[model samples]
Target: MASNDMIVAIAGGSGFIGAAIARRLAHAGHLVRILTRNPDRVRDRFDFPNVDLFRADVTDPSSLRIPLAGAHAIIDTVQFDGYPVENHRRGLTFERIDFGGTNALLDACDDQRIQRFIYVSGAAADAYSPHPGFRAKGNAERSIRNSGLPFTIFRPSLVYGPGDRVLTMFARILKLSPVFVMPGSGQQKLQPVLVNDLAQCVELALGGRGLNGSFEIGGPDPLTFDALIKLMMEVTKRHRAVVHAPAALMNITGAIAESLPHPIFSRDAATFVLADSLCDNSALLAEFGITLTPASIGLRYLAEGS
Candidate 1:
């Protein structure tokens, strides 16, 4: 259990990844402040002990001041709506939210009692990358590194667990469709980590000493996208014929998807599907001393109550 005196402020605590971290820290005896734009709507969602919801939007610099006041540490897991699909007209691009919002949060921490900064970045994050999401995450990482604050950045691979978007969506599709239409060649390799495991890493980082650096997080095994889909099928007990959609056609469909009020997919999303996200978990294991959960075992949640 962590010290009860510690107050951890999470910028995107209302979201999936942040909520898991918040719950983990709060349950471990830390006071968790969930910084969000809509506290009232999400108030009932976090009825757990030691959790407080504060209204704050990272996009709005002024709103962050009050919520981040006197925070012992800040964890950034802020991701914009319809993620991986940039709605530029609505100002939901990676630059504005991921990079810009992180900068705003760092600015707010200037006068505060902040001890550490933890950022949840992606495995493919690279400032020089052509992908917008990768570039934004890379830029955010660079800012955090140069902030002169003791920080631990986690570049997590594809994350899956309860309340996850990707795997859950795939499970839903498997249940309905006899043929599972996979994006691209279904050959892209991935190392998916459980959301709870990622939360555990954050908790460990907050407690451990001399653990200030970037860590690549992933599960025990690295498998192709098609293999992952098959594993999901085995777990969910839904066997469906897998059909690969050409990258070109998916790209076109994704481009069309971007025009929707709420895009479920985008051209970049297709590219993300085709990109390899493998990682070495040795560093994370050596530092955190955590035993990673395998996708085969962790994905059993899909089979429950079936």
Candidate 2:
């Protein structure tokens, strides 16, 4: 029930999650402004008639004002490049971008005529947690709650779909290797929601259905990490030996990976991987009326071009 003319601005709209939301809103006839640091580089990606690319970096407070001005709502989906790995030398830590950048956006909203504020927080967000990514998200959530604007925060559990890094990465591994090297015991449960369904949730939140509160969003089925990998194999028709690396070895590998210039997996990333990410979506269903996609059906997308 979103109006066609509402102006919605999305921070990090060039990213995986943000781009999906931008496409969904723009297709619904909303004027979508996509905020990114390098607009020209990503201009070709957004071919929608209603989508406009605005050059803005959440890390730089001064760059945000004009892009966010006069928007009805601002959805923040910004994450530092090489996520879950803190490139501190480049100022790409979770504290600087996720937490600090969100504060900057909130500060910029002072006179921008902004109404609702939506944040795409993670399932592992915890203010009290020692993990940098989790702590940053949890702190950002706190700031959004205290921002005094009617807000909606979504804590999505292991979002997966086309163009996603998580499941797609696993799929690539499954295609290449006879042995799938998994970290830890692979018993941790996950309920991964489809990226499109998450985009629809944002649309519903934009319509003022689920305002002034936080919601945990997830798919209907919760399965163990081992089961998820098996499902991926089933969909792709690639069966492989599942090898679980010991926690100590993973930690050592993560530590070594963190020192690399563009680290893909770190101790923090491993921590995230080993944890359970299940959530009850009754509230999300009640508010957004979303039909959650199961892993069995959604994983079929991996079979394409394989």
Q: Which stretches of candidate 1 lie over 4 Å from their true place?
A: 1-4, 260-262
Candidate 1, residue 72: CA error in Å?
A: 0.3
Model 1 TM-score, 2 decimals? 0.96
TM-score of each model, in listed order:
0.96, 0.97
| Candidate 2 ranges with C-alpha deviation above 4 Å | none
lDDT, candidate 1, equals 0.90
Q: What are the C-alpha RMSDs, in order, of all predicted structures?
A: 1.5, 1.4
- Model 1, residue 217: C-alpha shift (Å): 0.3
Residue 191, candidate 1: Cα error in Å is: 0.5
Per-residue alpha-carbon lDDT of candidate 2 for residues 190-260, written as tens digits (9 for 90 to 100): 89999998999999888877989789998899989999999899899999999999888888999999898
lDDT tens per residue, model 1, 152-240 = 99999999888888888899999988999987888899999999999998988788632568899998999999999999999988999
Model 2 TM-score is: 0.97
**Model 2 clash pairs?**
none
